[model samples]
Target: MDKGIAKMAFLHLSPPSSSSSFLLNSSIDSIYPKRLFHLSSNQHNRDASLQLPSYSSNQGSRIPAQWRIGVSFFVPFLDRSSEIESLKQQLLDAIAPLDRGADATPEDQQLVDQIASKLEAKNKVKEPLKSNLLNGKWELLYTTSMSVIQSERPKILRPNGKIYQAINLDTLRAQNIETWPFFNQATANLVPLNQRRVAVKFDSFKIAGVIPIKARGSGRGQLEITYLDEELRISRGNQGNLFIVGMVDPFYRVPV
Candidate 1:
């Protein structure tokens, strides 16, 4: 059961990583195990012999026998999964020095945007609003908004803990939460605007996870999910800000 930040933007060191570059690398490693490349020499020789020339769709040209050196040979180079993981690392490295974009300069933002655009172009979940990948507890990795990070506030008032946003596409609900120092949170309902967009209508807010206040008209806004996968998600807020988060829990649910 959780209630969170319905309309706030995100900022800060966030995920202890590029929200954790180390953790990101580890995740990629887990997805692609070494056993994939553990083909024995004997096995390679057998595979080489067994592979035959593959003809083109028109049957006018033939594929070299060497082109069929088993899936392992092509995994490191052509597997979309591996390619996605590689892009994730590149993105992590780009933001690892930005402090979840709290310290990002104009030039830094541009660089991050370039990389993010590439990921969005190859989004695995084309229609994120309807995919299970959209339902999860996503830890903020980088964002373009300053409000969520509270940079204008005196350091004392700035959140000293992590921020999280969770969603349940099935229920058309969402929440955002802060940890420690301030537990400010909010809850909202999601109205579908398109295949990848939603109009968010905030219903309530809780101060320090205790008090409750009903939402007003200002609580409403739009968000478009541009890119999504098993571990990463990229979103755009109504104000033209960009948000990048890494998935932590797929089964995350909002309290009904």
Candidate 2:
């Protein structure tokens, strides 16, 4: 799939609230469908009788006694599976920090679960994935050397002072899917949830951003990156370290 198409589908979440303002009017004839109106209690006065007018094929009037003529509006929320999924993932990310670590207690879990339930209800949740099924790791794609160190922290002033921002794609996927399931589900087939995996097929054709650079502890850094032209995925272990075994010929070079 085209990366642009996939990206758009992957992020479409909620419909605009203003869309509800559109009005629908239909004729009161057999050839034309009559628009149904929901009657509010305030609209009906003490001496008013709710009347509904209907027309036959011959344009004849048919009325029922004490008929209530009002509009009952129902918003059609359809084909939004992908958007919902995206929203679900966002929610997960927000709550992940609170629920992480060995110090987290049952109370934290309970709070997370309760908040999750509320988010699910708001988005009309569908299928839920097991949270702990897969191991999680951050992928070091492209990091800016000019790292933003907090003002309060001590600055390690050295010529080789490099800044690195480690990004966790797996965590991003999990967070977006968990929080905004509605949005993601709507666009799943367009982008595909499986595509979320950092597989070579997607990496070679998709990722957009800066080049991937590496900094070794020895103070020597290799800036081998193929940005814009294509994306690359580094094989990783549980600790987020790159796993390189066997012959290092074409694999050692920057991604094509």
Candidate 3:
């Protein structure tokens, strides 16, 4: 395959606008039709009681002007474009071998270390952690984390196909699905270890729609977030794997 075409194939698997929820639900229906029906029936009663609030045009106007002004000064601002770009480049270099379905070289391992160092430095600066910031869809650009990467194991780290992650803040759960050339799915429970760390316990893993691989013990492992903002996230796994993720179609509730 041509390099450009191969790269594109590896990165995006599904249509740009396809919802992860739709895909997941479809899989659930196929795998456990009876269970899904039962869940839907149970949810109907709950849905009827939970009415959505009506939007009011005057809602914003009700906020006191003085209060709004006072809050503005407390907002945090960070511009790390230069640093982010540097990290992105390093990640690209580190995963180049994998992109071609080749094994990572010693040099690639070195680049991974460099990326980890940069993430650690960024994590040292305290930044507020908000679930809203984490809830949404994200594309897996590059990762050394084995939890996400499964056995079809490219000798080189070429992560071809589309890998997407959907996080539900309300439920404190995360779902990941990949498709096209590679097919895998996993669900995890997100536990906040601290401001900059999270313990992701993998609940299950499924390959090619086969039986789910139930996680043994507490979960798969954990991840230490080094950097998180509107557009990017960098994390390190307990097993020394590095993860670099970028937003898919990020829509922030507040300005970053």
For each candidate, what TM-score against the reference? Answer: 0.72, 0.19, 0.54
Point out where model 3 deviates above 4 Å.
1-83, 86-102, 123-131, 145-159, 210-215, 251-256
Model 2, 89-139: lDDT tens digits are 333333334212112245644554444444334432121122221122111
| Candidate 1 Cα deviation (angstroms), residue 193 | 0.7
lDDT of 2 at 26: 5
Q: Which stretches of candidate 1 lie over 4 Å from their true place?
A: 1-79
Candidate No. with top TM-score: 1
lDDT of each: 0.62, 0.21, 0.47
Q: Comparing 1 and 3 by lDDT, which wins?
A: 1
RMSD of each: 10.5, 22.0, 15.9
By TM-score, the candidates rank as: 1, 3, 2
Which lDDT tens digits does candidate 3 get at residues 26-99?
A: 01234323221111111311221122234255974676898766544433222344455455445444554453
Per-residue lDDT of model 1, residues 7-97, tens digit only = 5333122222112100000012245232112122122111211223444566533545666575336544455655565666667767766
